[model samples]
Target: MKVAIEGCCHNKLEEIYKALEHIESVENIKIDLLLICGDFQAIRNTEDFKSLSVPAKYRTLGSFYKYYTGELKAPYPTLFIGGNHEVISYLWELYHGGWVCENIYFLGYAGVVNFGGLRIGGMSGIYNHWNYNVGHFETLPYNESTVRSAYHTRKYDVYKLAQIRQPLDIFLSHDWPTGITNFGNVNKLLKTKPFFGPDIATGKLGSIACDELLFKLKPKYWFSAHLHVKFSAVVYHDERTTSYSESKEMSSTSVENPDEINIDFDEELNNPDEINIDLKDGVNQEEKNKESNNEKTLQDYIIEDDKKEQIPCTKFLALDKCLPDRDFLQIIDFPEANGKFEFSYDEEWLAITKATQEYLTLSSNAKPLPPDNEIQKKIEEELRWVQENISQIEAGLVIPNNFQPTAPAYGQQQTFILQQPFKNPQTEDFTKLLKIQNKINPEGQSPIRQD
Candidate 1:
């Protein structure tokens, strides 16, 4: 599979698609998919500006509205996650992953999907310690605080991702993992962004939740943006193993297990009752006893499962923002990928979502997650239910083209916010498939057409 990975896309859709087309013309290779890491800025109409987190002066509509309104069609299959900057009202309508347009799909606040035989997973939004444990409390006509906090990474989303035991081919995040600097060329990074020295020295950069997921998931390739720099690093899973990175500028770094690391952890993670305390491999009574006795840390509980098969290392890459002469895009060839693949709902992810939808909260405060055993049992049950109920349908696991434009499109010259959010048919259909409540909106609309 010939896949293109783009860094922060600050609403430069035309430039990005044109660049990919230029590459295709020169190389004579077909690009199968495009994965964008955050800062997507899917602004539709002028009213969406009211919900955007950006300052009023910097709020300008980008090219996505054209695609939304069917004026322009995406040249390739595109998938993206949200970042700190987004149209919160629109995104909130499809919080559990849905087609943003004809060929473009949003991975929701956090989601996993199957495309071209690859199990692609991602978590949207940047991390903020203050809002990490909160619920989805943001609403339309967003106030200053809700607008910003709405995009902040939440524990419920991260916890759902952490439960996956299967291997992930590629993972995406808007922020780099905490302590990731220790595995890369910190000296060169400091030379370029000298102001980052203090944060690097104190091991205070990047997201702690992301760091935990990196160790827990241990995906084959992890890509990110938000730092606005092109940096690459490889994280070895074993105790002490050194390997050179594909990037020649620097060598990879090996480190100890997640259990032994003593980096700063939030107060909530330290409490066993609130957070899930099982290893990625699953939980045992012995480990639970160790956790209670202070013999193991919360990071240890989230570490890789020794019994399950493990990937040697996770190759981490963070690209720069989309601009002239910036390292914003990367093309990767998966020669081993075979057969034509269509976009579909991943069985494991569907099961996870079905099992954990009740846990999705709307409160402003933190909540407790299910124990490891309970989570495992629930996932297994839902997996079977999905196979019986959804996989048997004629459409099967394929994501149907049920897109419906509920908001005003660009060029409409409308400046006022709608009294209520239009119930996107895609969201309604997706939730209907899983038999879950539509938490984002209550109304419904019919599909206009399918591509």
Candidate 2:
């Protein structure tokens, strides 16, 4: 189906939707879904602003408040991943990922969601080697130095995606994959932003973990933001199949023998709400045929499933941030699986989350990241746990209780705060909302255990 893709939102929801609506009206085409890359500053209230990791100059309400106040609503269902410039204290609450509102979904720090039978995988935050293997322990009330820790992409999440043998239709990240410079018109890109050349030459442009995933996962399409300039590339995955991975460290993070790759497809995706693909009213029959044939599991499409062919090349697009007259937004078409594919947590991924618990998930006000040695040791331990227990977890014999699943940051649970919100948000009201979130939660639950 035709989907609208935006680069970095920076909380320009109203403008983006307005543009989407205008395009729909003009083209007479019904956009099925809206996918945002990152830098989605979901600053609903002032407390959210405080928790955001952006510099003071860049931290201001764009248009999300109107959506929060019910003054406006997105014209279509929206799905987005997290980025470096975000109110991560709020996102930290939804660690497993959930709907931000009725039609808005966050794809978690690193997650896979099925939309219209399309397996869309995403990695949140930019990758920095210093914080790459560090545990996801950075929490709320972050000081200047500590805030950067919140956006550092962790290896634990990447490890989960790494376990998937099935190919992903699309992948999203806040930053461009490091080697993307090689696939695209890097020389022309330098004309727009010359300073980027130094980083590109030194292989320091984007995330190293992301680069590894691009080569390893071999997704059909990879979309990103952060470098706010429109760029496109086609990565030939099959060209150098053996050398796809340059890093021995990332290549070694495989959970092969321990995982029962042949998971029961029956119980795989029972979560209807997560992957329901309802077609819009006005879509044409021709459009249906063009966009309906999605590649789900290795077995979902039997056309050529028997052979293990080298995966197809990946199309990479990194769009510019949301601003007036930015030539970054684009519309693209992708196939949807003809048959209903189950939408559920990937078995290995679920196992990793359950087994590793807080090591992969940083709770609000949790401890800071451990030192490098401790980080490496913990990662080794987590990997071992996944390798040993993945099969049991897949078979329903093991489920870890240490994980306190994250709560939804929006949706019905948060309607009270949005009830007739003041158009011009006052500090007192924002404070009250903050108190409701942190202190007197009507949900009768707190993220932290009461001593």
Task: Give the TM-score comparing model 1 with the true structure, all chains together.
Answer: 0.82
Q: Per-residue lDDT tens digits of candidate 2, residues 50-139?
A: 667655655566667556445676677688999877877656655566555445777788887676667788989877666666666665
Candidate 2 deviation (Cα RMSD) = 14.5
RMSD per candidate (Å) reads 12.5, 14.5
Off by over 4 Å in 1: 239-311, 413-416, 443-451
TM-score on alpha carbons, each prediction: 0.82, 0.66
Residue lDDT tens for model 1, 142-225: 888988888989999999999898999999999788767666666667787777776655545677778888888889888998
Q: Any idea what lDDT model 1 has?
A: 0.76
